[model samples]
Target: MKTERAISDEFMNALVDDQLDSDEKDYALREANQNTEFRERVCELRALKEMVQHAYPQVADAPPRTRGRTSLRLSHLQSLAACFMLLMIGGTSGWLAHDISSPASDNQMVHSLRALQQNDFGIHPSKYVVHVDTANPIRLKTALDEAENLLTTAQDTSQPSQVEIIANGPGLDLLRTGISPFAQRIALMQKKYPGLDFMACGQTIRKLKEQGIVVELLPHTQVTPSALEQIITRRLKQNWAYIKV
Candidate 1:
């Protein structure tokens, strides 16, 4: 029952920077996925990190500027930070900080998904990628529920659709043979829907193997080299609707 406040800024910064070890990283991802406040905290921190990087480029890459340039840049960054903090503290509703502090193009994928119409299931033949990054049982079941619902709805409407349940990090447990609770259900679903796909992150499997653990996936589940790459490059870029469950 660790609350969002219980997680310090340092820990969150580590999580954003990918500096945490496997257990810590998994815990952070699970919290961000399951907890609203924590998710916002992570998002805001990530945005700020990006802003900082943009404002202060590497010494090698950045050219020198005017004498007052550093202060001017700091002032601009401070304004952004102040606006972001004010929105959070004032309870402006539904990630308003993201809207005010960053441009639409700079917003994260989740932000884009949020603005997407629920009825608009991306381009036809509708395609969806359900992303799962935690091993939490409730979330695992929820992922199955989402994928099934999408497929079922498409079938009922006689619309051609594709759904892929992609798992990474601890979420890979959902596709692991003998480890997943819903193995039978997944097999049945695959039999029922030819457009449905299940994928495991090969990066996760490799890391597990490096730690001396044998990795095995349920039958019919394919492995992608990296879950992030697959989700961003192959799915999102291809106009597939994304569902994080």
Candidate 2:
């Protein structure tokens, strides 16, 4: 003989409603008799059916008010929660927009002042000076000639009352042994303008001697140890400006 399996709730319900075939109903009853839990569940279902039949009249008289109220309250709470979430999102988006749109706020006036200071018109003509420190001897001579021309033009126009030419560093070659190509022009400028000063760097002279180049003392030229410092000192103390070309 084969052992019977337990009856499921579906099988019990089918058997109770007379929906099962004879062979299936017999099998379900055999299983239900073997399993105590299944038998108990079937008995409870039968009792519930009888009570539901007796209570059908009372259930028809009442409406589902409690379920409807519960649903309404849940909808209201969900709407409130959704509104709060939207407000938070909107606030966060507003803050990000403000941060992105705002311009640089710190040191704005200071930056504007710095830009004004760098403007070309801030410096005056009398405060200007020129320093020539060229590497090539030919270029040095050419620059000297250009300076002389500029001085003559200034003197003719009387635009710049003060102009000085300080030649130092490698530019000392202009006053050294070999006769400069622009010697005649330089001599003429020196004779024409008494205020034009041509000075050489003493440091460059020492270096030139070490390199075995002879230094000849010239009449219109002067020498100094710290040429760059002297230029800076004159500019700052006497309101003289600088031109490097």
Candidate 3:
């Protein structure tokens, strides 16, 4: 059995080296396809051959130069040549080690590195800000959906836009978890686009809580009643483009 295994190993090597006849090579390749170990060994040999070729300096098909001794010292020339060869071998070994270890992770790292270097800054300017103000639960939800669609279009065109849904007065009730039909949608949109700011009136939150309504709404960064008024005032004062959805 040991002799038979040796003969099989020799046959596989011959097939890989292309020393076998075409029919025999085809049979060996087919057998390798079904044998993971054989396929891996073949790949390993190929990689080793490539590594050796890359590590060693290639000799030119020319006769050695016969020249007189140079002014440069022989020891210095030898040291420089030795350093160059060491550098070549070290570089090749490092590259091969990196290639064979964590290949998938290396590819992912390269992709992430490329993405980090790509800049998508200043590609668009803010065109408009949509303000949704309504008390009716159904209408408020419809308006929010429409506003989201407009924002999507702006993003698709690489155009910037802002949305400020000011739930003030009776409309402020929309920010109450169960009060607004669009509360879930609002939460989803906030997560999807971190840049899109959702503001609820602070006074309204206090009012709702006072009325014994449980309010698990958006974060405090998005809660500003005074800022809502200021936003509206600025849009009106500066005549900034606005749409009420």
Question: Which one is best on lDDT?
Answer: 1
Question: Can you give the TM-score per candidate against the true fold?
Answer: 0.56, 0.44, 0.41
Report how far residue 147 has shifted in candidate 1, in Å. 0.5
Tens-place lDDT per residue, model 3, 88-113, is 23323322122223244334433332
- Model 2 TM-score on a 0 to 1 scale: 0.44
Task: Please provide, for model 1 over 26-69, each residue's C-alpha lDDT reduced to its tens digit, 9 standing for 90 to 100.
Answer: 78768877899988777677566544644553222334486544
Each model's lDDT: 0.70, 0.52, 0.50
RMSD in angstroms, candidate 3? 29.3
Candidate 3, position 59, lDDT = 26
Pick by TM-score: which candidate is best?
A: 1
Question: What value does the lDDT take at residue 52 in candidate 1?
Answer: 62
RMSD of each: 10.6, 45.5, 29.3
At residue 36, what lDDT does model 1 achieve? Answer: 92
lDDT by residue (tens digit), candidate 2, 1-245: 11232256676676555567667766766767687776666655544443344334221333557764432222322322222222223222321111122123212322332333345554555544465655554357656765666677778888655556666555666655454445566667778876576667776677667779788745677776645545543342344555543
Cα displacement (angstroms), candidate 3, residue 149, comes to: 2.0
